[model samples]
Target: MTSTERSDTDRQGLSYYPWWLDNLADDATLEGAAMNGTARGAEAVRTIVAKARELYEFQDFSYADVFGDNGFLEIYDSSIQGEPLKVVVTVTRNAAGQAQDLAVLHRPRNSLLLFSRLMHEKCAGTPLAAHFLSDDSKA
Candidate 1:
């Protein structure tokens, strides 16, 4: 897709082709509330993001806009395992327009706990598992 092209929007007006998906830099990093520390590299970021998207039962974007010279921000309401979740995602891009940093913030302690647990379950047995809560930890 070209810079001017936008992907399809769902009923909730969420873009199917969010800018970050296609623009993540090779050494991109991901960090946020649901993560233990940080996930590095494009492949790791992609894996985590794809799994998170799958766990969301519904999403309605309330706001999305450019943040700064090379940043984009998105805020949305969503549901996972029937629990309501609110998220703010910020993406920072490199000079080439490739996303270099991605930050995700989830709200509502209860919802964040549930989301983190679910993510841990899905990432089990993978290298990415290290960046999530262990089974022994409280969800």
Candidate 2:
């Protein structure tokens, strides 16, 4: 698809946080503790959403339309690291019904180098910077 073109997913108005997610309230929390130098609420939301978009290469998927819940757990076949792989992503919603957490399981575990690199690059020199080079990357 062309970069300027919108996919059917886009036509459906998928976003980092869909309207249904507002049920979580403004103080809703994501899974991880706040990274150093970042605020807890909105900053956490932006950072986590940005990271997911980067990892998924901006593909849009709907939790409501696909799973009829806050989130879904699925395995994706990806070649982002230059070979076939199965990556498991578990998305969960907080009690308030906001999709607030994401966990990814790399099949080989060590296959996350590219993902880490991209995150590090994107987060560099900002309060959003992550210690992804260390074990804290999992946050």
Candidate 3:
């Protein structure tokens, strides 16, 4: 789609999906992209799609709850190597109906470990692995 069409569709909501996935996929990428100022810019969008492809085998996100009219939680039933992962993504939007912030919360134990393992495999040499790996200095 053209940039204008993309922007219009993003204004609709598919735009936020990538940022949500980026939060799940790689923190460094998200931070780096965010450095450019706008979360919905090209760098962030590319990172989101790349991370989604790298990490999740399949994902089905549905509206779990809505707070008032501008905030909501989206629950993702995702699979990695056939294992189930339940992730809750919470988002807050501005008055103009644009997302302002997003938070991703993963289920404990099995799901967290699965995500870490995927991060280790996918992120390897990247700084994003720290988001999953424990701090060695604390030991």
The candidate that wins on TM-score is 1
RMSD of each: 4.3, 7.1, 9.8
Q: What local distance difference test score does each model get?
A: 0.83, 0.47, 0.50
Writing each residue's lDDT as its tens digit, candidate 3 over 1-139 gives 3335445434333444444333332212222211212234434434434664466655555545567787767666666677776666666655645555555656555655666555545555655445443423121
**lDDT tens digits, residue span 33-103, model 1:** 98898999999999999999988876677667788799999888888878899999999999999989999
Name model 2 segments beyond 4 Å from true: 1-42, 55-71, 81-85, 134-139
Candidate 3 or 2, higher lDDT: 3
TM-score against native, each model: 0.88, 0.50, 0.52
Which residue runs of candidate 1 sit more than 4 Å off their true CA positions? 1-15
Model 2: per-residue Cα lDDT over 25-130, one tens digit each: 3554444222233224645555654564556533333222335466756444444435333455555666766655545555444445555555556677764555
Report clash pairs, candidate 3: none
lDDT of 2: 0.47
Worst 10 residues of 1 by lDDT: 1-10
Off by over 4 Å in 3: 1-53, 64-66, 134-139
